[model samples]
Target: MRNPLSDKVISIEPSGIRKFFDIVSEMKDAISLGVGEPDFDTPWHIRDEGIYSLEKGRTFYTSNAGLKELKVEICKYLKRRVGLDYDYNLETLVTVGGSEAIDLALRAMINPGDEVLIPQPSYVSYLPCTVLADGVPVVIELKAENQFKLTRQELLDGITPKTKILILPFPNNPTGAIMTREELKEIVEVVIEKDIFVITDEIYSELSYSGNHVSIAEFPGMKERTILINGFSKAYAMTGWRLGYAVGPKEIIEQMIKIHQFAIMCAPTTSQYAAVEALKNGDEDVAAMREAYDQRRRFLVNAFKEMKLECFEPFGAFYVFPCIREFGMTSDEFATRLLKEEKVAVVPGTAFGSCGEGFLRISYAYSLENLKLALERINRFVERLRAEKCN
Candidate 1:
């Protein structure tokens, strides 16, 4: 009998993050700081809108691009927040989630053997999605000294004649690193000069702890060449709602919508209505949640500092990538031992990419109480390791 699975799919490994999440689920008293999800409940008004949509029997499929109202709101939110303008009718597409938008963008643009520049220690999906899309995945290893921000030289180094796209994952996932406008200007120059397109995933835009988040699309000559992807999941605590959107040159978005149409038909109608509420009036809720996340972020940074651990301060998203090379263990080994001995679970940084070795990604999305308890366990584990090294 012939093998049923596609060889391409078989070559890809499953998500490394999921393994620890599954293990911690069944372990008694285990605490996980691995998942990058908000702890806040969806704001009441947003939930109310979804409920109201259902009560009004608005369950029918929306247009393939999504509800016109939601798309317009997304454009408005982008213009108001990031100063980037997009045409709602032709340039925007609502997706099942930001992950789907990522996949859609890759599939829409990639041709076989086209090179895609992917910065390492990024969200795991970008690399594999490029592979599945038949794009060559060129990894750009971001440096710890540079705070993991992709530099102009790094971008240039990754580009070649066949380079077609650059996946810009700012307010990055595992590192929580954000690219400021100054930093982004350098990258924008490289992208324009190289004549390569960009897929900038700004899903964590509102979670920025430093200054306001900046979008590469805001720069001159960039909007035409950039696909901007964002969603309500991180900012509005609407992860389970399964809604996200993309905005780009209409030509690219048209292709993405075509894929979304055949594959998903439409994003959830109720979620669309709720997201409208989120964009229109959920600013205060986002601000409150962001403030809470900022607090937790600071607490984690300081905890690592007091433990004498080496961790760079991350100014965006809700995670900290702390170096664990002092322990002389690979990220996987250290994380495994911590889980086995202390019942504290954190994702090995290698889950993001190979360059993430000797580091761990610890999310700060949990409550203060849980973070405090988990930190205590981690501190104990670290102290024990230090003592053994001295002996």
Candidate 2:
């Protein structure tokens, strides 16, 4: 038989994070900090709304863009939380997850060989998605000295005539970095000058520990050129709901919706009703969960410090990117050995990008008790490794 697979699919590696997660799943007594999922359950009120929708026999499909009420609520939530106003009817399209919104946006915007500038040590999806969309993936390796935030110089260096889009993964995964308003202004200047569009993934916006999460879309002239992707998963503890949305200029949103229409039809009808409830009445729930995550974040940062490990202070997302270069092991070697020796699981930084080879991403989304235990095991493992090196 002739070969039938697209070389693109064959060449792309599976998610590196999931490799350890799968092993951890089969091991008893293993504490996994590998996955970036919230430990909290979907708030009672949100779950109740989904059940209520089902009880009312409202399980039919929604419009291609999604339920009008849900889209309205998403717009309202954005306005109230991030201070950006978008037209619900024309500017927003619901997606299966922020993941799908990313894929759709890339497919909608990218012509073959169009260059997509992606910052490294970001969420793992950006590069692969760009490649699958037939765009060239240009990586900007963010530095730890800058707290892994993308720099304007780096942005300029990555751009060329073919550059069409920049994937802004902030409150970044694997390396919890966030771009401030002032910092975003510098980047906006570059984007405007370059005439390139931006796809900003703000899924972790609500989880920010800083004063407030600022969206690039809030910058002047940016809203028109930016595709803002967010979802219920991180903030509302609704990962299983698989619901996300993207908002942008009407023209781009309409094109994305066409792709979404044929590929997904709409986000889950039941989940849409529940998300409306989440946006309207779940502020207190989000606040409480954010508080808990903040506490855990602090604990993990301090624990790493006490162990003499170099962990940058991450203010946005739940993951901490700690430099493990001192141990003189590859990120994969360190993570694999740690999991085997300590029965604890954390993702290797290399899973995010090649630039992450000297680091490890430990998630603090677990309970304080689980985090404490995992920290203890990790400390012991580090001590043993150091001792062996000395001997």
Which number leads on lDDT? 1
Compared with the true structure, model 1 gives a TM-score of 0.99
Prediction 2 global C-alpha lDDT: 0.94
lDDT (Cα, 0-100) at 103 in candidate 1: 98
> In angstroms, how far off is 296's CA in candidate 2?
0.5
Off by over 4 Å in 1: none
lDDT of 1 by residue, 36-132 (tens): 8898999899999999999999999999999999999999999899888789999999999999999999999999999999999999999889999
Local distance difference test, per candidate? 0.95, 0.94
Query: Which tens-of-lDDT digit does each residue in 81-193 have in candidate 2?
Result: 88899999999999998999999999999999999999999888899999999999999999999999999999999999999999999999989999999999999999999
In terms of lDDT, the poorest run of 10 residues in model 1 is 77-86
The total of clashing pairs for model 2 equals 0
Give the Cα error of residue 316 in candidate 2, in Å: 0.4
Tell me the deviation in Å of residue 241 in model 2: 0.6
TM-score of model 2 (CA atoms): 0.99
